[model samples]
Target: MPSLTDSHTFSLPSSCSFLISVTDTNPISLAALRSTHFYLLGEGSNSIFVDDFEGVVVQNKIKGLESDDLNDVIMLRVGAGENWHDLITTCLKNHWYGMENLALIPGSVGAAPIQNIGAYGLEVSTFIESVEFIELETGAKHKIKSNECRFGYRDSIFKNDLAGKVLITHVNFVLPKSNYMETSYGELANLNAPTPEKIFNTVIGIRRKKLPDPRQWGNAGSFFKNPIIDKSLLTQIQHEYPDIPFFCISKTLVKVPAAWLIDKLGFKGKVLGGVQCHPHQPLVLVNIGSATGKDVLEFARLIMSRVKEKFNIELEPEVRLIGRNGLIEL
Candidate 1:
């Protein structure tokens, strides 16, 4: 077994039987795949490996880009192995409009659909046309339209019924040829006149100021998902804390920022062993040198317990935790 300490942003100590990097999708065979059970590993941005994995880890590296321009839309078929930030930069350079709000998301393209990655006021699901994946169990290729992806806040079909059964190979996005901008988020709400470059630059600037660069401070960006609660519950909380901010997801539901709740609980800058709740962004947990996976988990539990006790809301981790057996749900 080999230690995968550097593979994850958490810098957690873990191992696997073997690690294979698949560059291109050509010539894939079941005989080679079925010899050992495996887990698809992306850029390791959204994972926290709590323990050594006993099975193999497949690093998806498939890469390329193809475009078909229509009357008002450009359909882009992107290789899953490509860096997400690189894709956004390319789209901006080519005058693509839809991906500006999602700039600087740290992960590979293959992992985007799995988590339905999003930022600011836009989600990948909004621009996705379709997805192409290879079924690992049978070595069969399949395509599913974006509408069938079952997308939700930081969720998709890949995390549910199709989990561990397939590996995404490509994602096709339908981007607009003209003006279509999203700046509903508070930071971008006041932009005078936003272009693809302007929105992309704004998002990058905000993220840089808020999130610590993973290179300098090891962290999985936004450790917890924003909790969506019933509108009735939001009203109840609002009575006590009138300034509580939230976004209306539907008539019956409201999404509240987990960072606000954690900050309210006073966990920012708090440390447990080598792990600390980020000083600025309470939702992010950082490894302050010499932190182990267990250390990070303990710190997370502390935050969750306090938030639950105070707000009666359970915070769910956005980062996927990989254990010795398989995916571990906290």
Candidate 2:
């Protein structure tokens, strides 16, 4: 379910299909695993397993959704494996605010912080109070605050040194109880309504119409993180390509749209073998029919190289690469 690209003919490892619990997820028994090395961040939206490796793939089937409503805020605690969108829709159905800007992000709540999944004009970290994860080495559970997670533009500690070392079991977020929405990015700027529900539906509707349904096609959403550049480089690019869209990330860092750069470089909808850039959203890569992990990674590297050569901005992938080292070439 990773959103990188579609793949029906992938040569994946048999471990990917193994499940300790598929019918009712109660954390799989340690005895059942028999000392199998495994790692998990999020499922379905932000990452890919690459190949079917020797390690076991333990699906976090933990499930629950609850909210404590107060005057202007609602604190939500959700299971790690619960479908993120389903939980979002439930929150909206209960008239919860805050998360409206984050509608349609894929994967489990446990996996959200690894990359601080964001869309439209907001990222999940905006509301995250804390993240709960199980330490694999200690066999203990711990909670870390939002700031402690070291959240950045599409990054967090979970995806770095802490990656593959813990199993995220739960996540807590404090959302608004009243109208709260921020429409500052791209298409969202066109929104005029002030209601939180309007903002939520607008984002959800847009994503539903724009991104392909994972059930129908394989993909990991946007493959590459929008490049962050310095002010001088931004000014230089602005002069050369007036239409290049960018936003100031900090006094020293400005975020540039990698998709725009890729499309402008004439890579949009281009296909090679079994992989191709998404036609509708050039930022995404598609498996087309039966693509391999290597095919997609090689194509992605080409785009990254081109972006670096042309703009001097080093592009980084947001998707987590699982399995072996040679799975993809940088």
Candidate 3:
């Protein structure tokens, strides 16, 4: 039984009876988990375990990469357990374009689809061909096409109907040979004709400045989803605070930065016990040294309540909270 104290980014106190790593060619590990209540853990980048898990915790370590050239596009079938950033780096090394804007994101490939990871005007779903998984109950293998994944802003079927019901084994991606870089988000917009490497480096630099290194500071990247609001509501808010920053998602929808909302409430660097709303980025909550899961959750609630009181909009967490009972939604 391996200890999982350091397994999650939040460093929340937790324990499990068994910790197993499943690989690409092996279906037996997943089969053994059929009769047990289990939770699948990836790189622990987005997990905030509130309490000790009772049964089993499985980490996907499947590794392999298969590629095929198809005219203007190249397809890759990557093992679910592979590091997400490493995959992006490999693509860049091989001259494969796409995924440049998603650099520096933490977590394994298997966890990418669960959250439909996106950044800099590009989303993982844009290049995803399909995802392969094995049913938890029967160990039956299946491949779901990208169109059927029900991808939305930081959400997917894996987070809903299929949550904890299957183990992702592989993810297929289709990348183009030519440059199709995205540099329209925030600071990247200032770049002049960015290449894959340029876009990758730029995104990495921006993220490093905004987020804390998990190994040292302890954080799970962005804590809240950017709130999408109706255009009318956005207009109403903008009328009150003309300087409120927003992104036009559509004619009827707009995205308001949750960080801005938190910052508005004077939460930047606010501390509750051992947790602090990172001084530089209010969007990230970090453990200063002795924070417990309860402390983090409580601190998050304070931030949420203040945001709701001020903006009348509820902020949702991007990090999955796992307690002894199962997934905890805040």
Candidate 4:
């Protein structure tokens, strides 16, 4: 078995029957995929292997970057395997703009669209022109336009109907020359006369202060998504705790911070076995040392249960958890 302990950001002890790294899409073939169970992996920043996988683990490393500068918009075709933050830095250096607000986000470009990765007030989906992928079963290539992606808050078609069925090879992004700076989220909102460079630096600084370095402390960034609930529920919670922080998504929907709810329950720095809710950010679950898959599941369940009991809201995991066979629900 091939060890997967270092493959994922969570750094859990695990293994797989076979491991394959795909660097070029042309020569690759998945003829045997019909008979064998397989899992696609990128930089593994947003996934955790809880137990030994009973199948093959395909690591996507196809790499390339091409840019076409038009009069009004710059088109970027990025390889799925490219480091996301590095791409952002490259774009900034080239004065491509727009992606500055997403600086310091972990994982590969391929994984970005799947999660509809966003930060501050910008989402990757906003610049996405299209996605190119190869179907795992037939090895056929296909491209889906941005409008067909069904991008939502922390979601996309790749996470739904297409998950595990195709391998994303590249992402096309279109950035308008007249891009405006966004600083509406959290600490970024306080920036005085923000530029793309300023926003980039501030986003990096903010993430570093809030999120633990994955290499030093094993973590999958945010453990749970910020739950978006009905406005009626928000009003009910506000009655008990007046300062309950929330973002109005619409007239009927509200987005509540998961960290606040967990912190209110005193889960920050809370440890069970070897798994601990991050002290600085309660929404992140970290592997203190020698943490097992079961330990992570147990710790996450505890947080979810507490939040549900108090807030009457269900917390869904932001990170993907793999069991012995494949993906498992909390």
Each model's TM-score? 0.97, 0.88, 0.97, 0.98
> Which candidate's lDDT is highest?
4
- CA deviation > 4 Å runs, candidate 1: 27-30
Candidate 1 lDDT, 1-330, residue by residue in tens: 877788877877679888888887664633467667777889999987888998888888899999898999999999999999999999888877788888999999989988999998888999999999988767778999998999989999999999988889999999977767888887898888867777889999999999989888888999999999998988888888899999989999889999999999888998988888999999899988878778877888888898888888999999988888778877
For each of the candidates, give the backbone clash count: 0, 9, 0, 0
lDDT (C-alpha, whole model) for all candidates: 0.88, 0.71, 0.88, 0.93
lDDT string, candidate 3, 54-99, tens digits: 8789888888999998999999999999999999999989888899
- Which digits, one per residue and each the tens of the lDDT, describe model 4 over residues 51-141? 9999999899989999999999999999999999999999999999999988999999999999999988788999999999998778899
lDDT of 2 by residue, 180-279 (tens): 5687776778877667777777887888887777665667788888988888988898798887888887879878888898998899889976777878
Runs in model 4 deviating more than 4 A are none
Weakest lDDT window of 10 consecutive positions for candidate 1: 26-35
For every candidate structure, what is the RMSD over all alpha carbons to the true structure, in angstroms?
Answer: 1.3, 3.5, 1.3, 0.9
Clashing residue pairs, backbone N/CA/C < 3 A, model 4: none
Instruction: Pick out the ten consecutive residues of candidate 3 with the lowest summed lDDT.
Output: 23-32
